[model samples]
Target: MNLLDHIASVAALAGRPWHDHAALAADEHLRFEWYRDAVPRDEIAFLRLVLADPDREMAISAVLARIDERARSSIDFHSWADRVEPVCAPVEFLSRRLAEWRLLIDAFAGRPVEDAAVLAASDWAQRKLAAVVDGDLLVLLAEHGRTRRVRALTRVPRPARPVRLSDRAVTSGPIRPCYG
Candidate 1:
Protein backbone atom coordinates (compact mmCIF):
# COMPACT_ATOMS: atom_id res chain seq x y z
CA MET A 1 0.00 0.00 0.00
CA ASN A 2 1.05 3.59 -0.50
CA LEU A 3 2.06 5.86 2.38
CA LEU A 4 -1.32 7.65 2.53
CA ASP A 5 -3.22 4.38 2.43
CA HIS A 6 -1.11 2.97 5.27
CA ILE A 7 -1.74 6.17 7.24
CA ALA A 8 -5.51 6.01 6.65
CA SER A 9 -5.64 2.33 7.64
CA VAL A 10 -3.83 3.02 10.89
CA ALA A 11 -6.06 6.05 11.58
CA ALA A 12 -9.19 4.00 10.90
CA LEU A 13 -7.98 1.23 13.19
CA ALA A 14 -7.19 3.83 15.86
CA GLY A 15 -10.73 5.32 15.90
CA ARG A 16 -13.69 6.72 14.04
CA PRO A 17 -14.85 10.33 14.49
CA TRP A 18 -12.03 10.66 17.04
CA HIS A 19 -9.28 8.61 18.67
CA ASP A 20 -8.91 7.68 22.31
CA HIS A 21 -5.54 7.26 23.98
CA ALA A 22 -6.04 3.56 24.70
CA ALA A 23 -7.19 2.88 21.15
CA LEU A 24 -4.30 4.87 19.69
CA ALA A 25 -1.78 2.97 21.81
CA ALA A 26 -3.26 -0.33 20.68
CA ASP A 27 -3.25 0.87 17.07
CA GLU A 28 0.42 1.75 17.34
CA HIS A 29 1.21 -1.91 18.06
CA LEU A 30 -1.13 -3.02 15.28
CA ARG A 31 0.59 -0.60 12.90
CA PHE A 32 3.92 -2.29 13.63
CA GLU A 33 2.35 -5.67 12.92
CA TRP A 34 0.95 -4.45 9.62
CA TYR A 35 4.29 -2.93 8.63
CA ARG A 36 6.09 -6.15 9.44
CA ASP A 37 3.63 -8.24 7.47
CA ALA A 38 3.33 -5.89 4.51
CA VAL A 39 6.62 -4.01 4.11
CA PRO A 40 9.93 -5.67 3.13
CA ARG A 41 12.34 -6.57 5.94
CA ASP A 42 15.04 -4.21 4.71
CA GLU A 43 12.59 -1.31 4.56
CA ILE A 44 11.39 -2.12 8.05
CA ALA A 45 14.95 -2.04 9.36
CA PHE A 46 15.51 1.32 7.66
CA LEU A 47 12.29 2.59 9.23
CA ARG A 48 13.45 1.46 12.66
CA LEU A 49 16.67 3.40 12.28
CA VAL A 50 14.78 6.50 11.23
CA LEU A 51 12.19 6.33 14.00
CA ALA A 52 14.67 5.36 16.71
CA ASP A 53 16.68 8.51 16.22
CA PRO A 54 15.60 11.08 18.86
CA ASP A 55 16.88 14.05 16.83
CA ARG A 56 14.45 14.93 14.05
CA GLU A 57 17.03 16.79 11.95
CA MET A 58 19.48 13.92 12.26
CA ALA A 59 16.82 11.42 11.25
CA ILE A 60 15.95 13.48 8.16
CA SER A 61 19.64 13.92 7.31
CA ALA A 62 20.14 10.16 7.64
CA VAL A 63 17.29 9.49 5.23
CA LEU A 64 18.66 12.05 2.77
CA ALA A 65 22.10 10.45 3.04
CA ARG A 66 20.59 7.07 2.26
CA ILE A 67 18.75 8.51 -0.73
CA ASP A 68 21.99 10.03 -2.02
CA GLU A 69 23.90 6.78 -1.48
CA ARG A 70 21.17 4.79 -3.25
CA ALA A 71 21.09 7.25 -6.13
CA ARG A 72 24.86 6.95 -6.53
CA SER A 73 24.59 3.14 -6.55
CA SER A 74 21.80 3.19 -9.19
CA ILE A 75 19.13 1.95 -6.77
CA ASP A 76 15.42 2.98 -6.81
CA PHE A 77 15.92 5.68 -4.21
CA HIS A 78 12.69 7.64 -4.61
CA SER A 79 10.45 4.62 -4.16
CA TRP A 80 12.23 3.62 -0.95
CA ALA A 81 12.44 7.18 0.40
CA ASP A 82 8.71 7.65 -0.21
CA ARG A 83 7.85 4.81 2.14
CA VAL A 84 10.42 5.69 4.81
CA GLU A 85 9.52 9.40 5.13
CA PRO A 86 6.13 8.94 6.83
CA VAL A 87 7.44 6.52 9.42
CA CYS A 88 10.35 8.77 10.39
CA ALA A 89 8.02 11.27 12.05
CA PRO A 90 5.85 9.92 14.84
CA VAL A 91 5.36 13.50 16.05
CA GLU A 92 4.01 16.70 14.45
CA PHE A 93 7.27 18.69 14.36
CA LEU A 94 9.18 15.81 12.88
CA SER A 95 6.45 15.32 10.29
CA ARG A 96 6.84 18.96 9.15
CA ARG A 97 10.58 18.38 8.95
CA LEU A 98 9.91 15.33 6.81
CA ALA A 99 7.70 17.40 4.47
CA GLU A 100 10.36 20.10 4.24
CA TRP A 101 13.01 17.50 3.42
CA ARG A 102 10.73 16.04 0.75
CA LEU A 103 10.36 19.45 -0.90
CA LEU A 104 14.12 20.01 -0.65
CA ILE A 105 14.74 16.63 -2.32
CA ASP A 106 12.35 17.52 -5.11
CA ALA A 107 14.05 20.89 -5.64
CA PHE A 108 17.54 19.33 -5.60
CA ALA A 109 16.49 16.72 -8.15
CA GLY A 110 14.75 19.33 -10.34
CA ARG A 111 11.52 17.36 -10.02
CA PRO A 112 8.42 19.49 -9.62
CA VAL A 113 6.67 18.99 -6.32
CA GLU A 114 2.90 18.83 -6.03
CA ASP A 115 0.90 22.06 -5.84
CA ALA A 116 0.86 23.93 -2.54
CA ALA A 117 -2.77 22.98 -1.85
CA VAL A 118 -2.14 19.28 -2.35
CA LEU A 119 1.05 19.38 -0.29
CA ALA A 120 -0.71 21.26 2.53
CA ALA A 121 -3.58 18.78 2.60
CA SER A 122 -1.21 15.81 2.66
CA ASP A 123 0.88 17.40 5.41
CA TRP A 124 -2.26 18.10 7.47
CA ALA A 125 -3.38 14.48 7.16
CA GLN A 126 0.08 13.23 8.11
CA ARG A 127 0.11 15.50 11.15
CA LYS A 128 -3.27 14.20 12.31
CA LEU A 129 -2.12 10.61 11.89
CA ALA A 130 1.08 11.32 13.77
CA ALA A 131 -0.87 12.97 16.59
CA VAL A 132 -3.09 9.89 16.83
CA VAL A 133 -0.10 7.57 16.90
CA ASP A 134 1.61 9.66 19.57
CA GLY A 135 -1.49 9.30 21.83
CA ASP A 136 -1.15 12.71 23.53
CA LEU A 137 -3.72 14.35 21.28
CA LEU A 138 -6.00 11.36 21.74
CA VAL A 139 -5.70 11.61 25.51
CA LEU A 140 -6.66 15.27 25.40
CA LEU A 141 -9.58 14.51 23.11
CA ALA A 142 -10.79 11.74 25.41
CA GLU A 143 -10.53 13.91 28.52
CA HIS A 144 -12.85 16.51 27.02
CA GLY A 145 -15.87 14.87 25.42
CA ARG A 146 -16.64 17.94 23.33
CA THR A 147 -13.06 18.45 22.20
CA ARG A 148 -13.84 17.12 18.73
CA ARG A 149 -14.82 20.66 17.78
CA VAL A 150 -11.28 21.68 18.63
CA ARG A 151 -10.08 19.60 15.74
CA ALA A 152 -12.38 21.49 13.41
CA LEU A 153 -11.15 24.76 14.81
CA THR A 154 -7.53 23.77 14.31
CA ARG A 155 -7.97 23.13 10.58
CA VAL A 156 -6.10 25.44 8.19
CA PRO A 157 -8.36 27.94 6.51
CA ARG A 158 -8.34 28.38 2.76
CA PRO A 159 -6.92 31.63 1.42
CA ALA A 160 -9.59 34.31 0.96
CA ARG A 161 -10.05 35.81 -2.46
CA PRO A 162 -10.09 39.56 -3.00
CA VAL A 163 -13.50 40.95 -3.76
CA ARG A 164 -13.90 42.80 -7.06
CA LEU A 165 -16.80 45.03 -8.11
CA SER A 166 -18.03 44.75 -11.64
CA ASP A 167 -18.07 47.93 -13.75
CA ARG A 168 -21.66 48.06 -15.00
CA ALA A 169 -24.07 50.87 -15.89
CA VAL A 170 -26.79 51.20 -13.24
CA THR A 171 -30.27 52.35 -14.28
CA SER A 172 -31.04 53.63 -10.75
CA GLY A 173 -29.38 56.65 -9.12
CA PRO A 174 -28.49 54.62 -5.98
CA ILE A 175 -27.13 51.04 -6.00
CA ARG A 176 -29.03 48.73 -3.62
CA PRO A 177 -26.74 46.65 -1.37
CA CYS A 178 -27.32 42.91 -1.58
CA TYR A 179 -26.36 40.49 1.22
CA GLY A 180 -26.10 36.77 0.77
Candidate 2:
Protein backbone atom coordinates (compact mmCIF):
# COMPACT_ATOMS: atom_id res chain seq x y z
CA MET A 1 0.00 0.00 0.00
CA ASN A 2 1.03 3.60 -0.57
CA LEU A 3 1.74 6.07 2.20
CA LEU A 4 -1.79 7.47 2.01
CA ASP A 5 -3.23 4.01 2.30
CA HIS A 6 -0.94 3.24 5.20
CA ILE A 7 -2.03 6.45 6.84
CA ALA A 8 -5.67 5.55 6.38
CA SER A 9 -5.12 2.11 7.82
CA VAL A 10 -3.29 3.45 10.84
CA ALA A 11 -5.94 6.08 11.42
CA ALA A 12 -8.60 3.42 11.19
CA LEU A 13 -6.74 1.37 13.76
CA ALA A 14 -6.67 4.43 15.96
CA GLY A 15 -10.44 4.83 15.45
CA ARG A 16 -10.00 8.07 13.60
CA PRO A 17 -11.54 9.12 10.31
CA TRP A 18 -8.54 10.17 8.31
CA HIS A 19 -10.39 12.30 5.73
CA ASP A 20 -12.79 14.19 7.98
CA HIS A 21 -11.04 17.47 8.62
CA ALA A 22 -13.86 18.99 10.60
CA ALA A 23 -14.07 15.88 12.77
CA LEU A 24 -10.37 16.02 13.39
CA ALA A 25 -10.49 19.69 14.29
CA ALA A 26 -13.40 19.17 16.62
CA ASP A 27 -11.49 16.42 18.35
CA GLU A 28 -8.31 18.42 18.68
CA HIS A 29 -8.26 18.20 22.45
CA LEU A 30 -8.42 14.45 22.41
CA ARG A 31 -5.76 14.34 19.74
CA PHE A 32 -3.56 16.54 21.88
CA GLU A 33 -4.00 14.24 24.84
CA TRP A 34 -3.19 11.24 22.69
CA TYR A 35 -0.05 12.94 21.44
CA ARG A 36 0.95 13.75 24.97
CA ASP A 37 0.67 10.18 26.22
CA ALA A 38 1.21 8.04 23.15
CA VAL A 39 3.99 5.49 22.93
CA PRO A 40 6.60 5.91 20.22
CA ARG A 41 4.78 3.80 17.64
CA ASP A 42 1.52 5.60 18.17
CA GLU A 43 3.26 8.95 18.22
CA ILE A 44 4.93 8.32 14.88
CA ALA A 45 1.67 7.08 13.44
CA PHE A 46 -0.11 10.19 14.61
CA LEU A 47 2.67 12.36 13.25
CA ARG A 48 2.37 10.73 9.83
CA LEU A 49 -1.34 11.32 9.97
CA VAL A 50 -0.84 15.01 10.62
CA LEU A 51 1.91 15.35 8.03
CA ALA A 52 -0.32 13.72 5.43
CA ASP A 53 -3.26 15.97 6.20
CA PRO A 54 -3.69 19.58 5.15
CA ASP A 55 -3.54 20.72 8.79
CA ARG A 56 0.08 19.64 8.80
CA GLU A 57 1.66 22.80 10.14
CA MET A 58 -0.26 22.77 13.41
CA ALA A 59 0.25 19.06 13.85
CA ILE A 60 3.96 19.31 13.20
CA SER A 61 4.24 22.18 15.64
CA ALA A 62 2.56 20.13 18.31
CA VAL A 63 4.87 17.21 17.65
CA LEU A 64 7.90 19.45 17.89
CA ALA A 65 6.63 20.86 21.12
CA ARG A 66 6.33 17.40 22.57
CA ILE A 67 9.82 16.54 21.37
CA ASP A 68 11.16 19.65 23.06
CA GLU A 69 9.42 18.73 26.27
CA ARG A 70 10.87 15.25 26.19
CA ALA A 71 14.32 16.58 25.45
CA ARG A 72 14.18 19.03 28.33
CA SER A 73 13.20 16.14 30.57
CA SER A 74 16.53 14.54 29.70
CA ILE A 75 15.19 11.84 27.40
CA ASP A 76 18.26 10.35 25.78
CA PHE A 77 18.88 9.24 22.22
CA HIS A 78 18.84 5.53 23.04
CA SER A 79 15.43 5.82 24.65
CA TRP A 80 14.07 7.86 21.76
CA ALA A 81 15.53 5.50 19.20
CA ASP A 82 14.01 2.48 20.89
CA ARG A 83 10.62 4.07 20.60
CA VAL A 84 11.04 5.42 17.08
CA GLU A 85 12.69 2.56 15.26
CA PRO A 86 10.92 -0.17 13.22
CA VAL A 87 7.87 2.07 13.10
CA CYS A 88 9.53 5.29 12.06
CA ALA A 89 12.03 3.32 10.02
CA PRO A 90 15.06 4.86 8.40
CA VAL A 91 13.51 4.93 4.91
CA GLU A 92 10.39 6.64 6.16
CA PHE A 93 12.47 9.20 8.01
CA LEU A 94 14.68 9.81 4.97
CA SER A 95 11.69 10.32 2.67
CA ARG A 96 10.21 12.90 5.04
CA ARG A 97 13.59 14.58 5.45
CA LEU A 98 14.02 14.86 1.70
CA ALA A 99 10.50 16.21 1.33
CA GLU A 100 11.21 18.89 3.94
CA TRP A 101 14.46 19.81 2.18
CA ARG A 102 12.66 20.20 -1.14
CA LEU A 103 9.94 22.25 0.51
CA LEU A 104 12.51 24.61 2.02
CA ILE A 105 14.29 24.97 -1.29
CA ASP A 106 11.03 25.64 -3.09
CA ALA A 107 9.99 28.19 -0.50
CA PHE A 108 13.19 30.17 -1.02
CA ALA A 109 13.25 29.78 -4.79
CA GLY A 110 10.67 32.49 -5.55
CA ARG A 111 11.97 35.19 -3.21
CA PRO A 112 14.02 37.96 -4.76
CA VAL A 113 17.42 38.67 -3.28
CA GLU A 114 19.99 41.38 -3.84
CA ASP A 115 23.47 40.47 -4.97
CA ALA A 116 25.64 39.23 -2.13
CA ALA A 117 26.95 42.27 -0.22
CA VAL A 118 29.71 40.26 1.37
CA LEU A 119 31.34 36.84 1.19
CA ALA A 120 29.39 35.78 4.31
CA ALA A 121 26.02 35.94 2.55
CA SER A 122 27.20 33.53 -0.12
CA ASP A 123 28.86 31.38 2.51
CA TRP A 124 25.71 31.23 4.64
CA ALA A 125 23.52 30.33 1.69
CA GLN A 126 25.96 27.61 0.64
CA ARG A 127 26.03 26.18 4.15
CA LYS A 128 22.25 26.15 4.42
CA LEU A 129 21.92 24.41 1.06
CA ALA A 130 24.52 21.85 2.01
CA ALA A 131 22.69 21.04 5.24
CA VAL A 132 19.36 20.61 3.46
CA VAL A 133 20.76 18.39 0.73
CA ASP A 134 23.29 16.48 2.81
CA GLY A 135 22.01 12.92 2.35
CA ASP A 136 22.56 10.40 -0.43
CA LEU A 137 19.07 10.53 -1.87
CA LEU A 138 19.48 14.26 -2.47
CA VAL A 139 23.00 13.79 -3.76
CA LEU A 140 21.63 11.14 -6.13
CA LEU A 141 19.10 13.69 -7.31
CA ALA A 142 21.99 16.09 -7.92
CA GLU A 143 23.89 13.44 -9.84
CA HIS A 144 20.83 12.74 -11.99
CA GLY A 145 20.59 16.46 -12.95
CA ARG A 146 17.48 17.05 -10.85
CA THR A 147 19.17 19.66 -8.69
CA ARG A 148 20.55 21.94 -11.43
CA ARG A 149 17.76 24.48 -11.06
CA VAL A 150 17.96 24.52 -7.30
CA ARG A 151 21.75 24.65 -7.38
CA ALA A 152 21.59 27.59 -9.77
CA LEU A 153 19.45 29.54 -7.36
CA THR A 154 21.34 28.54 -4.20
CA ARG A 155 24.84 28.51 -5.70
CA VAL A 156 25.81 25.81 -3.20
CA PRO A 157 29.09 24.30 -4.11
CA ARG A 158 29.37 20.53 -3.77
CA PRO A 159 31.01 19.37 -0.57
CA ALA A 160 34.76 18.94 -0.87
CA ARG A 161 34.73 15.72 1.18
CA PRO A 162 33.20 12.45 0.04
CA VAL A 163 29.48 12.32 0.81
CA ARG A 164 28.56 9.37 2.94
CA LEU A 165 24.97 8.22 2.52
CA SER A 166 23.02 8.07 5.74
CA ASP A 167 21.84 4.70 7.02
CA ARG A 168 18.36 6.15 6.71
CA ALA A 169 18.77 6.36 2.92
CA VAL A 170 19.41 2.62 2.58
CA THR A 171 15.78 1.63 2.45
CA SER A 172 14.50 -1.75 1.40
CA GLY A 173 12.42 0.17 -1.16
CA PRO A 174 10.16 3.17 -1.35
CA ILE A 175 8.74 4.46 1.92
CA ARG A 176 5.39 3.16 0.81
CA PRO A 177 5.19 -0.33 -0.58
CA CYS A 178 3.45 -0.78 -3.94
CA TYR A 179 0.89 -3.51 -3.45
CA GLY A 180 0.17 -3.97 -7.13
Candidate 3:
Protein backbone atom coordinates (compact mmCIF):
# COMPACT_ATOMS: atom_id res chain seq x y z
CA MET A 1 0.00 0.00 0.00
CA ASN A 2 1.48 3.31 1.13
CA LEU A 3 4.58 4.10 3.17
CA LEU A 4 2.86 3.89 6.54
CA ASP A 5 1.49 0.46 5.76
CA HIS A 6 4.90 -0.76 4.59
CA ILE A 7 6.62 0.56 7.71
CA ALA A 8 3.96 -0.96 9.96
CA SER A 9 4.39 -4.35 8.34
CA VAL A 10 8.13 -4.21 8.86
CA ALA A 11 7.77 -3.00 12.40
CA ALA A 12 5.32 -5.74 13.19
CA LEU A 13 7.77 -8.29 11.84
CA ALA A 14 10.48 -6.71 13.95
CA GLY A 15 8.31 -7.19 17.06
CA ARG A 16 8.05 -3.45 17.45
CA PRO A 17 5.06 -1.19 17.17
CA TRP A 18 4.14 0.75 14.07
CA HIS A 19 4.38 4.08 15.90
CA ASP A 20 8.11 3.72 16.61
CA HIS A 21 8.90 2.99 12.99
CA ALA A 22 6.62 5.77 11.83
CA ALA A 23 8.52 8.48 13.69
CA LEU A 24 12.08 7.92 12.41
CA ALA A 25 13.79 10.46 10.16
CA ALA A 26 17.38 11.39 9.55
CA ASP A 27 16.70 15.00 10.32
CA GLU A 28 15.26 13.97 13.60
CA HIS A 29 17.87 13.97 16.31
CA LEU A 30 17.25 10.24 16.57
CA ARG A 31 20.14 7.86 16.92
CA PHE A 32 20.88 4.79 14.82
CA GLU A 33 20.86 2.93 18.11
CA TRP A 34 17.19 3.77 18.37
CA TYR A 35 16.60 2.10 15.04
CA ARG A 36 18.74 -0.86 16.05
CA ASP A 37 16.76 -1.14 19.25
CA ALA A 38 13.47 -1.01 17.42
CA VAL A 39 14.40 -3.60 14.85
CA PRO A 40 16.55 -5.60 17.28
CA ARG A 41 18.09 -7.79 14.62
CA ASP A 42 20.02 -7.73 11.38
CA GLU A 43 18.72 -5.07 9.01
CA ILE A 44 17.89 -7.53 6.25
CA ALA A 45 15.18 -9.38 8.18
CA PHE A 46 13.19 -6.19 8.34
CA LEU A 47 13.34 -5.81 4.58
CA ARG A 48 12.14 -9.34 3.80
CA LEU A 49 8.89 -8.57 5.61
CA VAL A 50 8.23 -5.53 3.45
CA LEU A 51 8.99 -7.45 0.29
CA ALA A 52 6.92 -10.36 1.53
CA ASP A 53 3.89 -8.18 1.49
CA PRO A 54 2.76 -7.92 -2.12
CA ASP A 55 1.00 -4.62 -1.61
CA ARG A 56 3.78 -2.08 -2.03
CA GLU A 57 6.89 -4.21 -2.54
CA MET A 58 7.24 -3.61 -6.27
CA ALA A 59 6.50 0.05 -5.92
CA ILE A 60 9.12 0.31 -3.22
CA SER A 61 11.56 -1.63 -5.37
CA ALA A 62 10.96 0.64 -8.32
CA VAL A 63 11.49 3.68 -6.16
CA LEU A 64 14.73 2.20 -4.85
CA ALA A 65 16.00 1.44 -8.33
CA ARG A 66 15.20 4.94 -9.47
CA ILE A 67 17.05 6.37 -6.52
CA ASP A 68 20.05 4.15 -7.24
CA GLU A 69 20.13 5.29 -10.84
CA ARG A 70 20.07 8.86 -9.72
CA ALA A 71 22.98 8.25 -7.40
CA ARG A 72 25.13 6.48 -10.02
CA SER A 73 24.65 9.55 -12.16
CA SER A 74 25.38 11.84 -9.23
CA ILE A 75 21.91 13.32 -9.20
CA ASP A 76 20.44 14.46 -5.94
CA PHE A 77 17.63 12.46 -4.37
CA HIS A 78 14.44 14.20 -3.28
CA SER A 79 12.84 13.85 0.14
CA TRP A 80 10.42 11.09 -0.88
CA ALA A 81 13.20 8.92 -2.27
CA ASP A 82 15.23 9.57 0.83
CA ARG A 83 12.49 8.07 2.97
CA VAL A 84 12.22 4.98 0.79
CA GLU A 85 15.96 4.34 0.91
CA PRO A 86 16.43 3.69 4.61
CA VAL A 87 13.18 2.01 5.58
CA CYS A 88 12.34 0.26 2.31
CA ALA A 89 15.12 -0.51 -0.15
CA PRO A 90 18.09 -0.75 2.15
CA VAL A 91 16.41 -3.28 4.42
CA GLU A 92 14.86 -5.12 1.51
CA PHE A 93 18.24 -5.37 -0.19
CA LEU A 94 19.78 -6.84 2.93
CA SER A 95 17.07 -9.44 3.23
CA ARG A 96 17.74 -10.63 -0.26
CA ARG A 97 21.50 -10.73 0.20
CA LEU A 98 21.47 -13.52 2.74
CA ALA A 99 20.55 -16.77 0.96
CA GLU A 100 18.56 -18.42 3.76
CA TRP A 101 17.04 -15.10 4.80
CA ARG A 102 14.29 -15.59 2.27
CA LEU A 103 13.50 -19.07 3.54
CA LEU A 104 13.45 -18.00 7.15
CA ILE A 105 11.17 -15.04 6.65
CA ASP A 106 8.98 -16.62 3.97
CA ALA A 107 8.42 -19.63 6.19
CA PHE A 108 6.82 -17.10 8.46
CA ALA A 109 5.00 -15.86 5.35
CA GLY A 110 7.87 -13.54 4.56
CA ARG A 111 8.77 -13.06 0.93
CA PRO A 112 11.42 -15.24 -0.62
CA VAL A 113 14.69 -13.34 -0.86
CA GLU A 114 16.27 -13.80 -4.26
CA ASP A 115 20.02 -13.33 -4.43
CA ALA A 116 20.01 -11.60 -7.80
CA ALA A 117 17.09 -9.49 -6.85
CA VAL A 118 18.55 -8.49 -3.49
CA LEU A 119 22.03 -7.99 -4.88
CA ALA A 120 20.72 -5.75 -7.59
CA ALA A 121 18.65 -3.93 -5.04
CA SER A 122 21.67 -3.71 -2.76
CA ASP A 123 23.94 -2.44 -5.51
CA TRP A 124 21.52 0.30 -6.32
CA ALA A 125 20.85 1.03 -2.70
CA GLN A 126 24.52 1.24 -1.83
CA ARG A 127 25.33 3.30 -4.89
CA LYS A 128 22.60 5.73 -4.04
CA LEU A 129 22.89 5.37 -0.31
CA ALA A 130 25.02 8.47 0.01
CA ALA A 131 22.56 10.57 -1.90
CA VAL A 132 19.55 9.19 -0.06
CA VAL A 133 21.16 9.79 3.30
CA ASP A 134 22.29 13.27 2.29
CA GLY A 135 19.12 14.23 0.50
CA ASP A 136 18.19 16.74 3.19
CA LEU A 137 21.41 18.63 2.67
CA LEU A 138 20.73 18.84 -1.05
CA VAL A 139 17.22 20.08 -0.35
CA LEU A 140 18.61 22.68 1.99
CA LEU A 141 21.13 23.78 -0.61
CA ALA A 142 18.44 24.05 -3.24
CA GLU A 143 16.28 26.12 -0.94
CA HIS A 144 19.23 28.32 -0.05
CA GLY A 145 20.04 28.77 -3.71
CA ARG A 146 16.49 29.81 -4.51
CA THR A 147 16.47 32.27 -1.64
CA ARG A 148 19.76 33.82 -2.66
CA ARG A 149 18.76 34.03 -6.29
CA VAL A 150 15.41 35.60 -5.49
CA ARG A 151 17.05 38.11 -3.22
CA ALA A 152 19.62 39.00 -5.86
CA LEU A 153 17.17 39.25 -8.72
CA THR A 154 14.45 41.35 -7.11
CA ARG A 155 16.30 43.26 -4.43
CA VAL A 156 14.82 46.58 -3.45
CA PRO A 157 16.98 49.38 -2.15
CA ARG A 158 16.57 50.16 1.49
CA PRO A 159 14.88 53.50 2.23
CA ALA A 160 17.32 56.25 3.16
CA ARG A 161 17.02 57.50 6.72
CA PRO A 162 16.11 61.15 7.03
CA VAL A 163 18.36 63.62 8.88
CA ARG A 164 16.70 65.35 11.81
CA LEU A 165 16.45 69.07 11.37
CA SER A 166 18.26 71.16 13.97
CA ASP A 167 16.09 72.75 16.67
CA ARG A 168 17.39 76.15 15.48
CA ALA A 169 16.04 75.50 11.97
CA VAL A 170 12.59 74.82 13.37
CA THR A 171 12.77 77.79 15.79
CA SER A 172 14.04 80.28 13.18
CA GLY A 173 11.14 82.07 11.61
CA PRO A 174 11.55 83.36 8.09
CA ILE A 175 12.95 86.77 8.48
CA ARG A 176 10.16 88.12 6.96
CA PRO A 177 7.76 90.50 5.94
CA CYS A 178 9.66 93.62 5.23
CA TYR A 179 6.41 95.30 5.96
CA GLY A 180 5.30 94.07 2.65
Q: How do the predictions measure up, each by TM-score?
A: 0.27, 0.30, 0.22
lDDT of 2 by residue, 7-67 (tens): 4554564665435534444565555554455444466666555444344455555555555
Sliding window of 10 residues with minimal summed lDDT for model 2 = 112-121
lDDT of 2: 0.45
- Report the C-alpha lDDT of model 3 over 10-107, residue by residue, as the tens digit: 66666667355456422122322333344335434554453454434453453344334433343233332433445554465532433222222232
Candidate 3 runs further than 4 Å off: 25-35, 38-45, 50-180
Each candidate: RMSD:
19.3, 20.1, 19.9
Give lDDT tens digits, candidate 1, residues 1-180.
443443444444333324343443445443343332332336545455444434445445554444445444543545655676567556565455445545444544556544442234343333443233223333332343243543443343534465555545546577778898
TM-score of 3: 0.22
Pick the TM-score winner: 2
Top model by lDDT, which number?
Answer: 2
Better TM-score candidate (1, 3): 1
Indicate the residue-level lDDT of 29 in model 2.
Answer: 57
Per-residue lDDT of 177 in model 2: 61
Clashes of each: 0, 0, 0
Each model's C-alpha lDDT?
0.44, 0.45, 0.39
What ranges in model 1 sit over 4 Å off?
1-41, 53-75, 108-110, 114-180
